[model samples]
Target chain A: MSEDPGSPKPIVTFLGPVASYTHQATLDAFSSSDFTLTPVVTIDDVFASVQSGTSHRGVVPFENSSNGSVVFTLDLFADLQHKYPDIIVCGESYIAVQHCLLGHPDSHHASHPISVSERTGGSRVGSGVIESPLSSGAVTPTSAIPNPQKPTARPVGDLARIKKLYSHPQAWGQCKIFLNAYLKGVERQDVSSTSRAAQLVAEDLTGESAAVSSVIAAKIHGLEVLARGIEDRGDNTTRFFVIRKRAEAEVGDATSVDRKEIGKDEQGEGDWKTLVSFTIDHANPGSLAHSLAVFEKYGLNLTSINTRPSGVENWNYIFFVELKGRREEGIEDGPVNKALKSLYGVCRSWRWLGSWENRLAR
Target chain B: MSEDPGSPKPIVTFLGPVASYTHQATLDAFSSSDFTLTPVVTIDDVFASVQSGTSHRGVVPFENSSNGSVVFTLDLFADLQHKYPDIIVCGESYIAVQHCLLGHPDSHHASHPISVSERTGGSRVGSGVIESPLSSGAVTPTSAIPNPQKPTARPVGDLARIKKLYSHPQAWGQCKIFLNAYLKGVERQDVSSTSRAAQLVAEDLTGESAAVSSVIAAKIHGLEVLARGIEDRGDNTTRFFVIRKRAEAEVGDATSVDRKEIGKDEQGEGDWKTLVSFTIDHANPGSLAHSLAVFEKYGLNLTSINTRPSGVENWNYIFFVELKGRREEGIEDGPVNKALKSLYGVCRSWRWLGSWENRLAR
Candidate 1:
């Protein structure tokens, strides 16, 4: 997947300081060697990077299976559409999120010496174990560096010794079952991202703090993983969108972007989805119903529907709807085009967020 | 509003350690002298208190004007309906959330002497300010207690001197404009609640830390307010529900419970609302459209709709719908009853969370 020496590799930016779930998704969707990956501080930064043309592409977490929609991402889409109409979701990928209880290696209780080698069976920290290429390559050198003095056995910690637990708020909610059983009453602090929590624990080696983060984060920050897969559900997955600005020629090409050929069925049909957002007349009782009926009328399948406060007024909302069809397919008389045309007639305002190949099954 | 000497005051529990926005809402809805208000650690605890009949009522935040839905409250309602079907939303109250920059009096930088007198005009530290009764009464005695030694001028803090800012995640979002403008690069830490953030800052007293919380929190914790109304919007508000367990005879009695009669309009027709959650067949693309159509067919106005992961399977979701009618008023050939009957026919599973007197205008 590495690019030729003469070719200028496209830069891909994602929400991160590195080792975040978004970073993992970015790696999954694009080959690191083929693209120069950069980490931005916030989700807004990811959008700004793509919008400003500083980065050729960007990735962001759209939703978590357990936590439902990421309101920040949805709200940003609504705001960015008007400002940067050419920005579109080019592709998407899912990463299975497994949260681990991570602590500063020095903070482990002396009574329980748990070495990194013992946990991974000496497979080298984060090497081929977490399915993240960045974590494996980034942490291998750090783990190989020998201490000047002989290293003492690293201590393993429990809830009793951990005075503080840091993680993204979503991670805390995902691991509620484990937290309630073991770390009940522990002070949980939320950080901007899970990797930031790990970085903080590493920086403040008080030996009294732990972070709920990904194994990749623990490896990148040289923290020890005390427990793995701590989320309440085993099937915890987060879907991320790989977005990019449309080309100059593609400015008004809402239904003409070339669809990527991947995950095709035997019938030679590739699954695809389109995202759109719009506002309706708040005074009409059945305005939402009338708007949604256009999909049914056009024989289009609606995958998801979410409502967010418009922030303009109380009880006023904007709806984000995902439909199961590509914008380009069967155009001129396609179900998606027909449904969208009828939708514009009913909605007060509307915008096409993007259309991309669908990855998640119905 | 005080109860008779012989009468036992009803116990009211809310999500709190006191000085929380929920506490303010509880006070606004019920007279403190008439009801013995208690602080519970979590929203779940508040629900448990009401479900177990340990408290006459419980108060929990329903939504924030800026951040939109409180998914925790919505998810809890979906879960609690099956276990305690009799528990209902009896009433509601709104609290205007004004976030204050609270810090330890001694932590201010030496160069900037920001006295409480200078910022609040010697207003007795949250005294007669901020509409919350809890702030006025609970902190008055402490604020009145003068130090034996003459007080030195407390130094005011700027963004550069503060090393960390603590607040609820919602507060961080609410005060984004202020934070981005003044404290661009300061480390932001998320606590359980706004008041809890104040408590932590008060406990640490490092002089380099601050909290974004209510004026009530600052007063109770003896912290000085460096600034007030720091939220992005002036009309920032959070709505809370006053919930109670219904009696056996009142199980089906949606109306006719003793109405508290606070904030009632002169017309005597109290607006009513009902909340219900249902899941539909994921394979059926138009199932949700069909289910929502039931509301339009029966003329029930939907004020809000939110989607949450059912948590049982991937791509499966439960829809929470808030409509403008009470269960009893539109039952027995009413629109609400007819709409619900049709909804049940289309959904895979459904539960009636509760119906309460509507407080927020459409």
Candidate 2:
């Protein structure tokens, strides 16, 4: 962490309270630098904070393991970048999330119970209220369910059949496929936080709804979990990011540690990549073809191109892309440069978000 | 709907009971055809039934208004394509869903009950145990909190204050950015289905967890709804597909509908699109890039290219792509086809999905 004595510390904004994962990711990314953290309330705030100068840089959610793309993040960034040219993604990081289910002590008959009965699956469906541990008043479970299955099957007497489910959206999405398969016909909903769901569930005498949240949510919500590790995908993780005003200074072996942990093929000559986003001028025929031709001419390989509705009326778009050699003078640049030159309109722009190799060690 | 007495009718499977929106969509899409309707136990069963030949066609989720892509459907298709060469996509469709919250007659307690309090922002959060005409036994209020500002908030009264949320994983990812902003600090948990979460919460009297699910989840689960229209993004609708071993009969008006929907002018000429999938050997450099170059040389425009990890270790990959123009030779054929031929072994194989226009309006 560099201490820039002369410069004002960079103000970094991210989603959350002190315990929020995004906040932790922000700290992890900028902890060594002369940057100050300003936890914001939401992902939109992260971008807004930076745009408004409330914070030098804003960090927020982008994508997840189970879910393909964080459409909301994409929606916000694409608009912000197109509307506001001043802002750019200087860097990004992928953080994994660890999730846990929470419930109250007596909510479930046993401390740890699994496989709620099929009949009771529909029991937990809505948000419930219970007395709070922190506050003098009782707190409601953000979600709860009534126990309906034969008590003998579950072994736990108080364990409620989880009809309702609570957790962050990402958390829910990752485990959805499995949940759909396992619970079959159960009700699920989204709440403010997992803890609130836990708190509410904790108050329930019947083990109906199970909150697929974090331990923190469980603690705050006062719910004792009936099941754990219920996610469909074993690799139930999410990647988070940290944004800063300026790039961080090189710390002792940090970059190397990152690279090593990610397990990239350092030996392979072409294991690196570059991601660029661009818009084409009024969906012209042969225009994109010609543009892509340039990359071929320059020997630049094209990787992936995803097209989405541009949100602009009468201007639905096609996002053409290419993944190839690094941008250098000696590389074949004829076709690529020509393609760029041939593109039309000031509306077209591109930004590189950096290249990363698939480094997860098997 | 046409039912041919002489010919073997194609079987088209849907998500559920006849009145469901998906079922309606299937009927609308195949109303003119001779087909049999097969109701599956679950969406997965729909896919399985199609693959296993138990049903000629199966309807499954594809995309949504609020959510970007129906990942499970994608995952299923991706997996099937990767595993079985014959499992191909015949046609596609877009459907919309409308949701409502309901409760049992006994749970509807409009009066200020002792167990709960007023809602926040004038909207009651406790939809729990509301005694309504909808059910027999316990009816949960969809909105428990009539006024959130009341200083005397009970732990059981504040179902709306729920920060922790739970739902199907896909729903969470689709609503990621929205949840990150509006409901920050809320713990997110993934369950089998949003419906499951809703069901569990409805049955539980103790409050804590909140589920982000369909309105049906609230009613079926016996829980109260604190709020509605909670998707991170509005226009929250999902597209479902009815896939079968056989394609929809080439009847009437469909082509016109497709052409009208897909027709667009680009580069002062009309252009239609075709979606294709292919697999390329992983070890070879410039293999996939080389294939793309084929399109470039022929002046054929490539719209989108999405790569799915083959799940097979390090040797295979599946690429879902969209390209301009049909397969018949027209523009430049030699170079393009040659490029494809050059990477024969590297290019495991390819399948054409369909070709239409840039946009498919619902």
Candidate 3:
């Protein structure tokens, strides 16, 4: 859906430095739209852009592969709700964080170059005919490159050539098996970020180092795939929420703001899910159980329920419950509205956070 | 309790510098013990130290004030369960993170030095009689220092003397109002950690720079207090779990393992809280609700509940439920034992993570 050429293109911002995973997700979310993509330094800035009407939409990480909730983002919602009450989630998109070992273009590759795409079930890397290394088959290492001056075979002895491995400290644990099995004792240098590791490798084209970074970073920084899918564990996929300001929210024009219809697209009624956060009288042991039952009573199956500490007090928590609902119906007539009304009695405080397309079910 | 002087002190490790909040909490947990307090570079190392028996006990962050679950710590439990199956949580402790504006002993203080202890109601800074800034009172700046060279009153004009402020990037947002009101034009430098910030100011001793760091850091680095409780929002109190290796568990003699008695102390049965994680068949909409209901039926009050992505699949999650229970009795005779057996019927898989003292109730 491209907008009118004459109209100012709606700005979309994400936690950036172009080839970061969040940037990759932002590009995929607005691939066909006429929106202009901008990079923000922090997630808080991404929310601020939408909240201030500087951007029509913002993409911020909602969940991590290993961590169900992106606490940084959730905490922002709790902290900034007062500053920007109209900020709401419109849609969500997921990006698989399949880390790859990148190298300078002239660097050597692994002996058996399994097709990264094939092993990862055709990730953003797209289709490849080569088989996985686990199945007793491997693609030629030269086939991994788009252009090759030296299309020689992957010398098994090349392990000695990699004098140093570069990656963010967080990546080291994920690739322990690989590091032990292949590059044992190779000097490892910790960089600030995975993308930064790739940039370093690209800049210093000595072909003596490799970085564990994203495929997008390799492509953006002119690095070659040394060995794909270097991460031996914690196969992570991050989900991001595309958010925007409710129309006319700044002027306090409540009549023009459609609360229930937020971020609704061509998806069917069954595809939409609404997320709400509430705090119960935690001193009362039964309050939380009673609140969960209310959602079940309305036949609103909670797809996900998580808790974040309400910063107002040390141990007090705000429970985030997401459930299927129809967004077409107005807030007053919607089943979510009715369930929330019942849920409120058991809650000390509550807020309807947002509604978005349920990627989990899809 | 003092151990035998002849015996080696039980080594306890934490994520640290000598004065990080984690270090502060670790000291508090073993205040009177004949234990060695060692510092580790990463949380994973802290876990590994206990798992490998390098440390008798390890203190790691379990929950953040704004995030109910410490994702890094929780994800480690999920990732390393098989490696350290007998690693059990022994106890927990809480530390209030009261950010202080620290400076070299010779640096200038704020105009109105309100008593931090009075305002925060006795953080680890302990008791002081000066009323809070809100209560319209000020303590002479020199009184804040142990051996003041100058006992003169705080000059509001001294705000212009601050050429730069150092802090971890995370602290800037927490103290926005204070920064805006006083140090608006000061050059802010981002350091690696809050403790490091205090060190910078201490080593420089320029009196023209200050740091936003923990009070503990100020004491450790010999920095004088300039202002206290600078964080205007998101009053964060982190909870830490003190973990230890279960005795003789690497032998895999399950029969000899007494799970319920893993971490019994002077605390009564009513003070204990057990945390367990499980995954349910998400295909059925009622599975989670059913799992939650089993707890209510068993009279277990769920103190906290959170979800983490299973990491095996994109949308799949493992639920963490913490409930108040008695652990003195044998596992077979305990009320939690019956509830988990009943709870497992609704789940595809489960694990009894650990039990600890619920510090929140106190």
Q: Give the best candidate by lDDT.
A: 1
TM-score of each: 0.81, 0.61, 0.68
**What tens-digit string does per-residue lDDT give for candidate 3 at B1-362?**
12245866677888776687788788877642556778776678888888888887788878766435666688777753577665767778887777777875422344445345333353232212232343332322433534211221131123344567887555665666566555654656655457877888888765778888887898888877666665664355778888887665321212221222233344454677887888888777867878887777777878788787775666778888888874333456577778887877887787776766566644
Worst 10 residues of 3 chain B by lDDT: B147-156
Model 1 Cα lDDT, one tens digit per residue, B27-134: 887777667888888888888889888888889998888888888888777773365665678778889998887876532334454443343343322221222222
Chain A TM per prediction: 0.80, 0.62, 0.71
Per-residue lDDT tens digits for candidate 2, residues A119-172, read: 244444312211223222222333332431112111122223446665556676
Estimate candidate 2's RMSD in Å.
11.2
lDDT of 2 by residue, B320-353 (tens): 6556654334343543344344445446776645
Among the numbered candidates, top DockQ falls to 1
Model 2: DockQ score: 0.18
Candidate number with the higher TM-score (1 or 2): 1
Question: In CAPRI terms, where does candidate 1 land?
Answer: acceptable
Name the weakest run of 10 consecutive residues (lDDT summed) in model 2 chain B: B148-157
List RMSD in Å for every model shown. 9.8, 11.2, 11.3
Q: How high is the DockQ of candidate 1?
A: 0.44
Better of 2 and 3 by DockQ: 3
